[model samples]
Target: MIPIADKYSTFARFYDAMSGEYPVYHAGRNIGISLLRQRPGAQVLDVGCGTGLNFSLLQAQVTQGGTIVGIDRSPEMLVQARRRAERNGWTNIILIQADATALSPAEIGSRIAAEGGRARSDAVLATYALSLMADWETAWANMVSLATPEGSLCVVDMQKPVGLATVLTPLAKAACWLGGSDINAHPWTAVKRDCVDVKAASARGGHLQIRAGTRRAGT
Candidate 1:
């Protein structure tokens, strides 16, 4: 079997085309970003920001005055992200390649500072990304540490379909399997547990779970 990293690297160029963004995943991100409700000039961090799919939506919220720091483990993926940023003439984006679960927050904060962003962002988002990590909780902790005291947090991930959507279970599992994600991971639960005033939404027949909220103090 191809290693996950290699798989991502090899597939980076084709990821957006095969990712089912329009039909399946985009709704979750839309809900998550809408719930985040960031203001103009806000700084945002996107973990596992593959091909910068969230960039356009985030840009709509933060505008040109704001900063966007995108982190992903695959260098090839970062390349695609950078290309997307350049293609749209978005100069406010800072792409970094690193393992989200293992990075040092201080170091990453410093790096962001070097790129003209604040030490901590005003908002943090992860879409269809966390479930790919075996140690997703550690990544979640890092996300918290990289945000401001009351920064907005959003997580969008997948699960088995429910109710009438149960008929799509096999397709959902196939997509998750192709992406090397644990469909049962339920990483958004951490957001619900650790964040306050959490807003929840689901789409695609409950196959997509989205949670957004403010970071609790001292968390």
Candidate 2:
């Protein structure tokens, strides 16, 4: 049998517990909401979505019938996620025990069919999870693979601020390797993708929102 947590399995169970106490949780949800405003009926994919924490926040902003998909590699985390959805009556939520670095349309299609035949999502949202992805670029590409041309790709993550983004980038890189990641890079290494960059309003004491770009026909 495979280890449930490749890099974060152990951390997954305590993720929400740690994040609940995390002061950034509030600002994080706010940024995701703000970035997703332009997309209607947005099919938001919370990549590495831990315990479906962002589902409630996105559920309200997207169209009434909108769906929110949360995918993570840890089954332990998914256990809690099942409870979160059931408790919140978040019928729109679907939690998958999968890897973020491998997210793609084909994979998502299989999962959807297993559920009930839903189409690709309008957008993808990766909160606080990008920094931990095994392959940030491929993960970003995969999320883009799941979005529609008219939809948006919203990313919410923690930053070390002006002096810190640069300083912490390498540290994150090392951590990624030790955590079983060989891609050896952070998602924001370049931000050179064809998409546009929308900077979220700087909340003095909250998470940061970054709208990288709207999905453009198979981007």
Candidate 3:
């Protein structure tokens, strides 16, 4: 079997078209971005930012003066993300190729700084991406470390559907499996555990979980 990043490199071309964005996954991104509540001129970090799917929503919050740094391990995905930024005439977005779990905070910060972003971001978000990480906790730690003490952190990921949506469990499982994700990952739990004043939401019969909060001191 191919490694996840290598697999995504090939999948990057048709990702936006076939990733179920509109009908399924977009809801989580929308909710997650909303809860971030970033101020104008904020420096935002997007981890595992495949094909820049969160760019539009993040742009609306950060505005022209703000910076949006997008990091992904796959070069092909970064290529698509660059295309998206170019097509939109967005000059404030920076795309970097790096593995979230493997890179240290200093390395990521240095890369961001080299691209004209601040060493620490004002807001950080990961949507539907953490569960794909083999060491998501490390990624989460870097996210926290790369943000200011009181900066916002948001996580959006999938879980088994509940109630009426439970009927779609098989479909959900198949989707997650195809994407190389563990449906039960519940990566947002890290937000609850490490951050304060958490905001939570669910969509698609609880299949998507959104968690956002300010990073607590010493966490």
Candidate 4:
């Protein structure tokens, strides 16, 4: 099930503390930057982006010339994100209020055209957001719709809970309240399966990315 917007609206303030700066978000950002190749400029989208925490890192990778659009359903979260954008003087970045799953190709097409078209975005990203979605299927489908034929897509989510770490249950439960995280016991695995099953398109050819990882870069 997808999480209600209210669930995250309440936790925008303490999200970073809940995430533990060194581990969760930062780690994901590092990996994303490397995968994106830190191109001097690339149009990018951060689907389900929360509080714009990943912006600075992603911007650094894509550079000042790059464009990033961060979308989320919670205004409270987007408020924080806007604050960050102003703080960074990021004129190229735009924030939108919406669910990731609803990011249809038609919507993406219009928005991209309005924002200066040319299929500017080379990357589509989802970091620490999918696990909290109420309808992961729609969200996954929307992501497929948003990316270009050649666009690179990357996602970083918590690994599913392993067999009863009875001792860690309390800690895991606490993490959930902070940002509705860990709602999916097997988030990564489940999403990976969906990705694999999805018939997606790429610049070179039609393809699918599965949780089982049937195909991937440098493979």
For every model in order, what is the number of clashing pairs? 0, 1, 0, 12
TM-score of 3: 0.98
Q: Local distance difference test, per candidate?
A: 0.93, 0.62, 0.94, 0.62
Better-scoring candidate (TM-score), 3 or 4: 3
Error of 4 at 67 (Å): 0.5
Tens digit of per-residue lDDT, candidate 1, span 1-219: 787889999999999999999988999999999999999999999999989999999999999998899999999999999999999999999988889888889988888888777889999989999999999999999999998999999999999999999999999999999899999999999997889999999999999999999999899
lDDT of 3: 0.94
lDDT by residue (tens digit), candidate 3, 47-102: 99999999999999999999999999999999999999999999999889999999
Instruction: Evaluate model 4: give its TM-score.
Output: 0.74
- TM-score, cand. 2 vs. native: 0.75
- Give residue 22's error in model 3 in angstroms: 0.4
Q: Model 2 over residues 151-192: C-alpha lDDT tens digits?
A: 677766554334435555555444334444332233533232
What lDDT tens digits, residue by residue, belong to model 4 across residues 93-146? 877777666667577656656766333357677776777776765676666556
Regions of model 3 farther than 4 Å from truth: none
RMSD (Å) per prediction: 0.7, 4.6, 0.8, 7.3
Provide the lDDT at 148 for model 3.
94
